[model samples]
Target chain A: MSFQISSQPIDLAVLRNALAHPHAGACATFEGWVRNHNDGRPVLSLEYEAYAGLAEKEGARILAEACAKFDLVAALAVHRTGHLQLGDLAVWVGVTAAHRDGAFGACRYIIDEAKARLPVWKKEHYADGVSAWLNCAIRGGFSTAAGPPSGPPTG
Target chain B: MKTVRIQYFALLREQRGVGQETLATAAATAGELYAELRSRHGFTLPADRLRVAINGEFAPWDASLTDGVELVFIPPVAGG
Candidate 1:
């Protein structure tokens, strides 16, 4: 399992190849992109920041937890920091397993956990010439019972 | 009294007008330290809206303070 934070654009092909294994028959991947709008407001761009030390540690732990909770061969995730234009990839998760269920389950688990647990923040630059730091409020509270990201991530 | 290094991020960093600082403090735990700094810095966020980290690890608000520690007050995060 590997978790990394990159300031540059993520290379998806590299990540996909890294998860290749002879025993793995299934692969699942997720990509979070910067959308053109959010909360009914137009978004021109986004900036991401991270407390690298804790983020990497927590992110890796999330991947490890997903591997344990599901049968998997490998799990990897990358989160990008710095300025990102609309449609740019903000985060990516990939998993490989012997079966489709394990791969898909672990992939979802990793992204959800990483969003809630990692010490990273996102700032949205709106077309209205205002930029604000997004919080759990937009998502209607932290880590809902239905499976959204939670606070502190240690839980 | 103990001296600790503190780092801020996002809103806190912008509000504090600096990313990091070092200070000697009389507070005994992370919670007290945040209260103290909140007053001194006029930070707008409440204790309940934040989390604490000591030496690059997530720590409880009531975690005890120690000399020469690196501390961070994490705001609500939105990653993914």
Candidate 2:
């Protein structure tokens, strides 16, 4: 029942311990890290910003949904905000359940749902003067370096 | 009358120039209230690309509004 959206870095050990319980026979964790390159350019850094209150609320909702839909015993999700360097952990999600299938399914659901629904946004800082908005296509099965969106421009 | 708490995030926050606000309106649906806010704030957002959460649950724009409900607007972004 832990949900947090903070500017501070996430503590993985704490998350792992929280998911360790007798009732849970399996635990699944997902960590999202900042990459060094995007769109064939060297990324300087990334700044993640979010409406903290809303983000937390959304995380809780997603957690609740997972619990309701799966046989999960416990769940924790945390997303980092503010400036982050390359290879920094951007998001962490851990789920524990009575069986392997439930743990894996719930963990995947949480990560995909968070990316699709969370209010957090990333600003990619590159070596060149150019920067672009990051469109999180979790289910779109495409790479981030696919160039600028070929569709009509968005406001 | 109902008062809805509205929260903006990321680029939308920058565009709106504020993070949160409470609107006291007689609007029946979230979509109506969003239209009012867009006109007042003079900000353009791709409503189809964005998602809305009412009281911590993902909801459609046509969802009915209630007093003291927290309305959150989320823009699409990447994460692992």
The alpha-carbon lDDT assigned to residue A28 of candidate 2 equals: 89
The 0-to-1 C-alpha lDDT of every candidate, in the order given, reads: 0.85, 0.77
Model 1: per-residue lDDT, tens digit, A1-155? Answer: 78999998999999999999999999999999888877678889988999988999999899889989998999999999999998789999999999999999999899878877788988888899999877623233332223343331111
- As a whole number from 0 to 100, the lDDT of residue A85 in candidate 1 is 90
Per-model RMSD to reference: 4.4, 6.2
Give the DockQ (C-alpha) for candidate 2. Answer: 0.35
lDDT of 1 by residue, B1-80 (tens): 99999999988898899999999999999999999988988776777777889999999999999999999999878887
> Stretches of candidate 1 above 4 Å error?
A136-155
DockQ of each: 0.57, 0.35
* RMSD from true fold, candidate 2: 6.2
- Tens digits of per-residue lDDT, candidate 2, B1-80, equal 89989888766677789888887988788778777777887655646566888886678999999899998777675544
Which window of ten consecutive residues has the lowest lDDT sum in model 1 chain A?
Answer: A146-155
Best model number under lDDT: 1
